[model samples]
Target: MTSLSGKNAIVTGGTRGIGLAIARGFLEAGATVTICGRKPENVQNALDALADYKDRLLGISAHVGKSEDLEKLISASEDRFGAINVLVNNAGTNPYYGPIVDSEDAAWDKTMEVNLRGPYQLSKLVARKMLSSGGGSIVNISSIAGLTASPLQGIYSVSKAGLIMLTKVMARELGRQGIRVNCICPGVIKTKLSEALWADPQAEKQAAAMKALGRVGTTDELIGAAVYFASDASSFTTGAVLTVDGGMVL
Candidate 1:
């Protein structure tokens, strides 16, 4: 296991699903973690679920789309855990499940705001702190949908594709400064955000059949990848995209 002992990390959209799983993995790996959720109750719930690591876990309610909230989350985390050594941009949303042309402006705005803009804005803030601290690592959670467009998730695909580039761009710009930026493109995983793709009986079967592993993955499966990126295990790695999709079609 990759050790993140003594590291301070921040995970966005960490109330449940992948984010929560990653937070738990980080705590177990010996890192101080601060997770943010949009709802206070959701944040509390996640905190409760992760009670085993209460001493090392912190939950805050903040919206990634808002700059003020992002600043507060960062500031509060820094004040509590010292400088953040790892950042996971895992918060995202796909409001519309339809053709690109049919997507409304609101859907497009919200999708970009959460999936793309939030990461971009938050990264900038974290980068500033990282720059001052010598260096850090950033792990972005993208999706295979970003690599290949989905008919129904058109807008979401576009946003995630942009995230892939964002990872590379930041990696190049920050490498010289000691900050390593990488991305993870996960295939269909059984999570709340991805339930539309695998929840129904027929949907589950079709989704499983599409993967080379003949099945969808669980949240825990992505933990190793997250840990590797966040820890020094991949110290020399930057601007890389690791796909953990059970060999699903790209």
Candidate 2:
């Protein structure tokens, strides 16, 4: 049982799916959490749903791919909660799902900007604060697409793969400063973002057969790993990638 009690956290793309699950788990573990989504209504809905936590939870509308929005989110987290001790880089986008040769420049750039660049920028901002405040943990929500090639997801795969290396770079450079950086690669989660893979009967069956667990995973299934990475349980773990993919790659 890991605990994040007394910790302050920022979860990006936290209004729904995996990010929302992570935020709920952090609140349950006694941490003050600031969650952000691009849409104001989604943020408000999340805030209302999590109102039981009262001052412990804050919801902000921000786009992870935008530098100015990212800055505001960090400032808001500090103003409301204090020095951020945990950052879960869960915001990601997959705009063009096609062959790499077919991907246009805009598609490639958008995928990279949101999935890879966003995490890098957010981690840099939070790492500085962690260094000043005695260190913290960063958990990036990458995907199994990073570890292996996926059909029709070339650019998204490339972006996630880049994120894995970025995690290593950050961990190696920031370790001395007490910031731990890690990555999580999830597989076939039944979220709207992944509906195309799982909503179709043939695709879902094929995906499930590839996993040792014999089924696609749910958003809640990834929470434990995120909590572990965020808490002291993984204090010595950095630059590591944890796969919560129901053994799909195996």
Candidate 3:
């Protein structure tokens, strides 16, 4: 296992699913973690679930789309765990599940606000702190959807593709400053956010058969990739996109 001892990390949208898995994996690897969700109850639930870590795990309620909230989350994380050296931009949303031409303006705005803009703003804030504190690593959780567009995922695919580009830009700009930026593009993970694709019996079977592994990915399966990015194991890896998609994209 990759070790993150003495590292301070922050995970957004960490109340459940992949974000929660990444947070737990970070703690298991011996890092101090601060996680945030948009809801108070979800934050509390995650706090309770990770109680064994005690103060090592801090849970906060913050909307990634709000700059003030992001500021507060970062400030509180630093106050509790010192300088954050690992940042996981995992928060995202796909409010619409329809054709691109039929999509409304509000859907596009919200999708970009949470999926792309939030990470852009947060990375800038974290990179400045990282520069002051020596260096850090950033892992953006994009999706295979970004690599290949599918029906009903047009806006989301665009936003995620933009995120991948953002990762590359940040990595190139920050490499000399010691900050490594990379992206993970997962496919058909079994999470609530993807219930529409995996919940129905027929759809689930089709989804499974599409993957080389013959099944959808679990949240825990993405942990190892995240750990790699958070640890020195990926010290030389930047501006790269790791796909953990069960070969569905292949």
Candidate 4:
């Protein structure tokens, strides 16, 4: 098991879904965690939900795409936890779903800002703290859309593809500082964000059939990869994209 007894981690967009699961996994592994969301209510809700592990959890409100918000989040984490040893850039947006030609400029800009730019900026901010703390790990929650084009979600796909590149770039630039960066590409996970696909029986069946494993993934299925990348288990691994898509890409 990957132990994080003395480590501190910050997970963005951690009020629900995969982000919540990752925060839970970190707490279970004994790391002190700070979770952030865009809304104060969501942050409070997450704090309530994780009250059982209050000794190691802190919840805050911050929008990952905004520089000022990101700065406040980093400052709050440092104030509560001393130093940040792990960062999970799990917040992202996919507000538009259409063909590439039909995607409006606003949707494209929003998608790129949240999915790619947010992580990029957060990584840069956190890498500096990690260097001062002697080292750390960063796990970006990208998507299989980044690996293969999804015509229906063209703009979102482009943003995620940019995220994959951003992950590699951060990994390369921060390696010398002992900060490892990697990404996870999950496919059709059962989350609210993916409700549009799984909400319909036919669509769910079709999605499941497309995977070699003959099933869709779950939030729990991706936790191990987060644990691996955040822990010493993957100390030498960086600039890598671990696909947790249940054989969808195979």
TM-score of each: 0.98, 0.98, 0.99, 0.98
Off by over 4 Å in 1: none
Superposed model 3: Cα runs more than 4 Å off: none
Q: Relative to the true structure, how large is the alpha-carbon lDDT of every model?
A: 0.94, 0.93, 0.95, 0.90
Candidate 1 clashes between residue pairs 3 or more apart in a chain or in different chains: none
Residue-level error in angstroms, candidate 3, position 59 = 0.6
Residue-level lDDT tens digits of model 1 in 1-250: 3899999999999889899999999999999999998999999999999999998988999999999999999998999999999999999887899888877899999999999999999999999999999899999999998899777999999999999999999999999999999999998889888898898989999989988899999999989999999998998999999999999864
Residue pairs with colliding backbones in model 2 are none
lDDT of 3 at 233: 94
Per-residue lDDT tens digits for candidate 3, residues 1-250, read 3899999999999889999999999999999999999999999999998999976999989999999999999999999989999999999999999998898999999999999999999999999999999999999999998899877899999999999999999999999999999999999999999998899989999999999999999999999999999999988899999999999887
Best by lDDT: 3
lDDT for predicted candidate 4 compared with the true structure: 0.90
Model 4 residue 149 CA deviation (Å) reads 0.6
TM-score of 2: 0.98
Residue 205 lDDT (model 1): 96
lDDT, candidate 3, residue 48?
90
The TM-score of candidate 3 is 0.99
